[model samples]
Target chain A: MKKVYINSIGSISAQKTFENASFLETIADYNDTVLPAIDPVYKDYIPPAAARRMAKGIKMGVVASKIALAEANLENVDAVITGTGMGCVVDSEKFVSAIIDNNEEYLTPTSFIQSTHNTVGGQIALGLGCNGYNFTYVHASISFESALLDAKMQLETEEAENILVGGVDELGAHTVKIHRLINHIKPEAVTSKTVLNSKTSGAVFSEGANFFVLSNLRAAQTYAELLDVKMFNTLEIRTLSKAVLTFLQVNGLFISDVDLIILGNNGDVAYDTYYHELTDKVFAETPQATYKQLSGEFHTASSFGLWMASKIMKSQSVPEAAQLNTIQTSEVNTILLYNQYRGENHSLTLLRHVEV
Target chain B: MSELREELKEKIIEQLNLEDVAVADIADDDSLFGDGLGLDSIDALELIVMLDKDYGIKLSDPKEGRKIFESIGVMADYIAEHRTK
Candidate 1:
């Protein structure tokens, strides 16, 4: 089987992640119910004509892919895979609202065309003129992980040399309001420093796009070897630890061998306990870290967590802002990332530092 | 004629969410795409809808928009000749 490595990564999140020099140096502490990405100059990456009709999610995904490709020094990839939970929600809301408000008369096609879940992947392929393979997954929280797994499988099977895989979510006003109605968003805005300790039922909702250029060939800029990625559609809290152990075992790793563990604790009082189960029990000694506090909670926000893991592996330093526990490792080599949403769609990713 | 062109620019800005651009920034004969205003395929779709909704000119294919939306001058001319509403 061929090996897989992350050649490059790009993220546009609530924090200033697009400019490579900054690493959450100053975060937008939100007190509102929904947080939007700290957008880059879209015109700098996307042409005006092509960007005219793109929804926020599509813009982020396409711009992020461009940044990742530019970093990888490639113009096109063999495949484009994307994950979006709500899937072009800004357009979806626009179309649906138009249908209702206009009473189904003279409705335009722009929103309908942009509302498709695969539009981002399609637009990326259109932009790059790459027609090899395109796929989009909309499986709620695990959508991004599903895209990652698909890209990894293709790389391992030698079906594609380089693939662009990404996850994106955009906040819609109506969607945010409805989620707040159900307590899926925090009752009030919480700062990044206070998100985990908010002790709220809902999370601090946010949006972002994280993209990676994954290839079978390792290079100088490669972040880490994607040892293995696994996802579960439904995993109970009791089964979570065992499932993680099995995932590590398949990768020939033990709980103690993990130099760092990144958890997706999104400040949901109801579901943060899932992380507590492992952090307090099975992997107490492993240095624990989390990113949702910095990035905010979205269905595909775990993609940002993966980006953070890749950065930590390459830099061999974990940002003090992300540290979840005091346990420190002298040499950072192996990193494990665990994420789930509202107690479902759990994922565990194992990454190993390359010697070169 | 000039009012129609100005209206078109405002409609385009509003419909396409050109949040940073203003109607005054657009010249009547300036290109709607590429160098002039940097509109793209997505913007073309928005213009297509404007043609249909406001002027009652329905374009089945997006390619039809390339000529009609070349500029505010061309768009207003096409809409003047083709508008049913």
Candidate 2:
């Protein structure tokens, strides 16, 4: 089996972390219930002719992937895989609303064409003229992790050497309104300092795109070695502890071996307890960190968390803003990322510092 | 003819969600795609529906739309010639 390494990563989130030089230097500090990504000047990466038809999610994904490829020093990849929970939702909402408001008349096809879940992956392929394998996953929160697992499997089996994999979600006004109605978004704005203690049932919703180039060969610019990735469709709260231990055991590691543990605590009182369970029980002694408060909560927000983890392992520095516990490690090496959404679709990713 | 062209520009902006661009920015003779207004395949579809809904010109194939939607002037002329409504 071939070893998989994250060669490069690009992310556009609520925080200013898209550029390689910056690492959450200045946070957005949103007090609103719904937060949107700090968009990059996409024209710098995508030509207006090609970008005119792209939905916000597709544009972000494509631009981020371009940035990742540029950083990896590669023009094309063997495969492109993407994950999006509410895929091309701005277009979807537009199409659906037009159908309703116009009584099915004067309904344009652009919105409908861009509304597909696989549009981002297809667009990436079109942009690169890459006819290799392309896939998109839309299984809610685990969507991005599933894409990563697929890419890892392909790399391990030697099916493809370099793959572009990413996760993206764009906030739509209508979707936000409905989610707010259902109490999925916070009722009021909460500052980053107070998000964890909001004690609310929902999270501060946000959206972003995180793209990475994974290759079987380690290079000088490689971020980290992707040791293992696992996802669970359903994990009972009681069995979660045992599950984590078994996962680590299979990976030939223990609780103490993990230098830093990244947790996805979105400040939802209902789901934050899951993080507490592991933080208080299994990983109490490990240096802990979380990023949702910085990036806000989205279906694919865990991708941002993984991006942060890769940065920490590569730079050996955990931003003070992401610290969840004071147990500091002398040197950052092995890091484990755990994330879930609404008490379901849990994922565990292990990455190790690769010395070039 | 000028009114029809202006109306077409409005429909295109509203349909394509060109929220950043205004109707006045679209010159009648300027290209609707590529360098002029920066439309693409998705915008072609939106214009196709406009042709069908507002002008009663049903073009089943998108390939046929390329020649018809070259510019706002071309679009208005095509609708004026074939519009059943």
Among these predicted structures, which one has the highest TM-score? 2
How well does candidate 2 match the true structure in TM-score terms?
0.92
Give the per-residue lDDT digits (tens) of candidate 1, residues B1-85.
Answer: 8889999989988887787789998888999889888877766766777787789999987788888888999999999898999
DockQ scores of all models, one per candidate: 0.44, 0.49
Local accuracy of candidate 1 as per-residue lDDT tens digits, A1-356? 99999999999998889976556667666666567898899999888757877978999999999989988999999999999899899999999998898688767778899899999999999999998999999999999999999999999999999999999999998999899899998887788888898888999888999999999999889999998888898999998899999998888888989999999998899999999999999999889999998888898999999899988988889888999999999878999999999999988888999876
TM-score of chain A of each: 0.98, 0.99
Candidate number of the best DockQ: 2
Q: Write the per-residue lDDT of candidate 2 for residues A223-332, one digit (tens) a residue.
A: 99999999999999999989999999999999999999999999999988989999999899999999999989988999999899989988889999999989999998
- Candidate 1 residue runs with Cα over 4 Å from true position: B1-5, B17-21, B25-85
Regions of model 2 farther than 4 Å from truth: B13-27, B30-45, B55-85
Candidate 2, pairs of clashing residues? A31-A189
- For model 1, the docking class works out as acceptable
Give the distance in Å from residue A81's predicted Cα in candidate 2 to where it truly belongs: 1.1
